[model samples]
Target: MAPTIPGFDYQRVQVADGIALNTAVGGSGSPIVLLHGFPQTHLMWRHVAAALAADHTVICPDLRGYGASDKPADPDGVSYAKRTMAADVVALARALGHERFALAGHDRGALVAMRAGLDHPAAITLLACLDVLPTLDMWQVLRGTSATVGFHLYLMAQPPGLPEQLIAAAPDAFFGHFLDIWSQRPEAITPDVRAAYLDACRAAVPSIVADYRASAGIDVAHDQADRDAGNQLRMPVTVLQQDWGALLGFDARALWSAWAPDLAHTTVNCGHFMAEEAPEQITAELRKLMAR
Candidate 1:
């Protein structure tokens, strides 16, 4: 059986025609939906969700193309677009009876949340993004040797067939690479959680690759259009990120501020998997964000 969030009830909710998200809903009161990052399932929020559940209705979902969620074939390039995934998130919340809710996402899910904040501004009352830059700023800042840190981003962004075949041949090693190294507190994931993540990623290789490919192409274009139009997040936004800016040669605050006028950007010391490595800190940060 897949490892799950303690005290959380799991269900499959239809977010789009023929696409239902595997979601875990817990707690009570105001709603806050947490979206998981790449190489992870909703289980990544195991610690934070439980804490937030105390005073809020916490929703966690395996995004389409990841975990137990439906992975529809992406024949058209836009299928796995962040816009599409953002729409899935909005739909998931609406299906769960939340017309407006707080939103938080880690990594790839953060990208989707960012898009949702721009596209469906009125629906998201508060926004929190964990450890990532908006797509357009991300591409703009990654340059020279500093860019080597994101080799997987470029690898998966390649044309469809090759990326899928290469990753499928060694799914464990490929997905495990991220799960193994991205955390300072590796023990936070535990063995069962690691197994669950690898299993999910292995089973959803094609769709996962398509999702990354979309980030490189259509996702970037969408962000650019939003930027060109002077659009910004309409809600109170909080960003908890590793201090990767100096290494990558860019100011995370400046980049994020361009998009979020009411922003709380913090430089965290935890590893890439901050939600797991520093759940206490993250949980505190999230509570602070929601309180705003």
Candidate 2:
């Protein structure tokens, strides 16, 4: 059997016309959905989700193009946009009988949660994003040698064929590169979990690339539009991030404040994969976010 969140029940719920997300749900009161990040599945939340499941109905799903979820083709370059994936998440929650819920996401998944909070304010009671800046700010902050760290973003943002061809040529090396470097606690991801992450990412290369490509294209445009209109996340928002600002030379909290009016930003000491590296701290911060 595929690795799962031990006690949580799993199901595939249709979130769009022909697309359904593989979701794991547990616990009972006050729902809060957790979206997983790149090169990892909903299983990344196994530790955090289980803890939250004690008091909250925790919903963890592989985003539309990752893990066991549906990977739709990006024929129009908008299919894998964060807006589309965010809608998938909102739909998934409603399908499971939640009209409103707190939402949190990590890395790529955090991007989706941010979009959802902007587009569906009434449905999201509170929001938490882990270790990423908004798309607009992200593009703005990277300059000079600092931008080198995000080379994957540039690579996948290229026009279709080449990026896909290159990554697929040596799938493990490409995906594993992030898995290896992004974690401060290497032992946090065991061999079995590492294998699962690699297997899923290898099979979903095209869709995953399309997802990143949209961020460089349509996602940027969406963020730009929101900024132009003074759109902001209405709910109470919590942002947990590594000290990218210290190294990259930008105020992370100030940038996030532009998009989230009611914001509480915390700089974490852990690596990018803080959900796995510091679940206790993540859980505490999340509980605090929801209590707001």
Candidate 3:
């Protein structure tokens, strides 16, 4: 059986036609939806969600292509675009009886949250992105050797055929590589959790590739159009990142400022998986954001 968040009830929620998200809903106060990133599921929010559940209705959902969620085939990558994924999130929240809610996302889910904040601004009361920049800013910062660490981004961004085949052949190793490298506290992801992530990724290879491919193609276009139109996230936005901007020699705050006029950006000391490694800090920050 898949591991579950303690005290949380699991359900398969239909966010769109033929696309039902595997979701966990818990707690009782105002709603706050959390979106998980790549190589993992809503399970990544195990620690933080439990804490947030005390004072908020914490909703955790596996993004469309990951975990126990339905993985719709997207040959042209449109269905998996962050815009589409963001829509899934909005729809999920509404179905769960929340017309407006606080939103938080980690990694790829952060991309989805960012898009949602822009496209569905009225629906998201506040936005918190765990460890990512805007899609356009993310692509802009990828230059020279700094981009090497993000090799997987380029690898999976390729056309459907080969990337799917390659990842399918060694899904565990590929997925495990991120879990090993991206966490400051490797122990946070126990053996069971690691195995669950690998198993999910292994089963959803094609849709997973489509998710990344969309980031490279259609997602970027949506971001560019938003940027060109002078659109900004109107809601309060907070970003927590690993100081990659300082190491990569770009102003992280400056890049995020363009998109989030009312923004609070912080460079965290923990690794990319902040929620797991520093659950208390993440929970505190999230509560602070929601209160704002």
Scored by lDDT, the top model is 1
lDDT of 1 by residue, 42-84 (tens): 9999999999999999999999999999999998898899999
Question: Over 4 Å off in model 2, which ranges?
Answer: none
Candidate 3: tens digits of C-alpha lDDT, residues 1-292: 8789999999999999999999999999999999998888999999999999999999999999899999998956699999999999999999999999999999999999999999999999999998887778878888898789889889989987899898888888898999999888999888888889999999999988899888889999999999899999999999998988866778988998999999998878898888888889999999899889
Error of 1 at 144 (Å): 0.9
Give per-model TM-scores: 0.99, 0.99, 0.98
Tens-digit per-residue lDDT, 1-292, candidate 2: 5688989999999999999999999998999999999989999999999999999999999899899999988889989999999999999999999999999999999999999999999999999999999998899888899899999999999998999999999999999999899999988888889899999999999999999999899999999999999999999999999987988899999999988889999989988889999999999999999889
| Alpha-carbon runs more than 4 Å astray in model 1 | none
Backbone clash total for model 3 is: 0
lDDT of each: 0.94, 0.94, 0.91
On a 0 to 100 scale, what is the lDDT of residue 176 in model 3? 90
lDDT of 2 at 282: 96
lDDT of 1: 0.94
RMSD for each of the candidates: 0.7, 0.7, 0.8
Which model is ahead, 2 or 3, in terms of lDDT?
2
